[model samples]
Every structure is written in C-alpha cells, then in structure tokens.
Target: MPADTARGRLPGFFYRFAHPALAVVSTVGSLLWLAGFALAGAGVALRASDPTTAYALFYYGSLVSLAGIAGIAAVVAYLVVLWLLRDVLDVLDWEKPEPGARR
Candidate 1:
C-alpha cells in the first residue's frame, strides 16, 4: 500500500479539505444564486424606466448566477466522487492488484 492509499481510504488531506469545500459550495453558493435572482428581478422591474442601470444589473446578475452555478456544480461533483468511493472506504479488500501475469 502506498501513502495515497493509507488505511485503504481517501487521503486524510482530502477529508480535512472536504468539509470546508462542501460548506462553501452548499451554503454560500445557494445564497449567491438567490441574490442573483433578486438582482435580475430588480432589473426586469426597472427596465422600462432605466434601461442602462437595468442592463447593468442584469449583466451582473448573469455573472453572479454563473459563479453560483459553478459552485453548485462543484458540490454535485463532490457527491459523485464520494458515492464512487463509498466502497473504497468500507471494504478494505475491494481491490487487489494482480502482480503476476503470463501472456
């Protein structure tokens, strides 16, 4: 077993970072997305009177929304990785390298 495969589970470093990553993606990401929605709605409301400001707000909202979407995507990716690694953390002998082969 190599250092990366310590104890047949994900690296300790990954665990240490995963918590903060999930927190940022799940919490802050959601808040940003909602804020984007609010801004875009405000833009729509003001479009008739102030097209300039409304367009600016709409542009900003789009950018913020994209950022939020990226963050949320990261969270989903983390879930998928965790799901794939579930057995790795559970079963110690799930994988056994074959060192000998005759071909």
Candidate 2:
C-alpha cells in the first residue's frame, strides 16, 4: 500500500481567512517596499550626481532601472516569505502561560 495525499496542504477555512489577509498584507507590504525603494533610489541618484543631473537621471534613467530591479525583488521576496510560512502559519495552537503561574 502507498500513501496517497498531497505533500503539503492547508485547510479550506484557513485559506478562506488567509487569502484576504494575505492580499491585504501583501498589498501593504509591497507598497511599503516600493516606496522605500523609490526613496532610496532617489537618494542614490541625488548623491551620485548634481541636482540638475540628479533630476534628469532620476526622472529618466534611475526610474526605469530601479523599477525593474525592485519589481523582481518584490516578487521573489513575497514568494519566499510565503513559502517559508507554509508550515509555521498552519499551526493554530496558542502558547501556554509560564509554568509558575496559575490561570
């Protein structure tokens, strides 16, 4: 006899709750990530060249370049984080109080 089952699976209810939560979290996380990348990109552009040059490069060169890199990073990061959480997030047990204390 052979085991017949999916290697990794989450409960349906868990998915129902997690789908919306993940969407909300991923949306906010992505925005924050991109905003930080934008700010940092601007800062680098400003530091790398003069104000006039920075304006030109930022508006033209850096925007396109950083956009591609940041987009890739965001996708990879989101996937990796979600994959790592696969096991940990499925557990629903609550932590017990300290051993010395009564409830």
Query: Which candidate number has the best TM-score?
Result: 1
Clashing pairs in model 1? none
TM per prediction? 0.62, 0.31
- For model 1, residues 1-103, the per-residue Cα lDDT tens digits are 4655656454344455636558656667788888899999999999999999999999999888888888898898987776666654653344433667422
Q: lDDT for every model?
A: 0.76, 0.56
Stretches of model 1 off by over 4 angstroms after superposition: 1-21, 88-103
Which parts of model 2 are misplaced by more than 4 Å? 1-18, 48-103
Candidate 1 has an lDDT of 0.76
Tens-digit per-residue lDDT, 57-92, candidate 2: 456554554555565566568767766666468443
Worst 10-residue lDDT window for candidate 2 reads 5-14
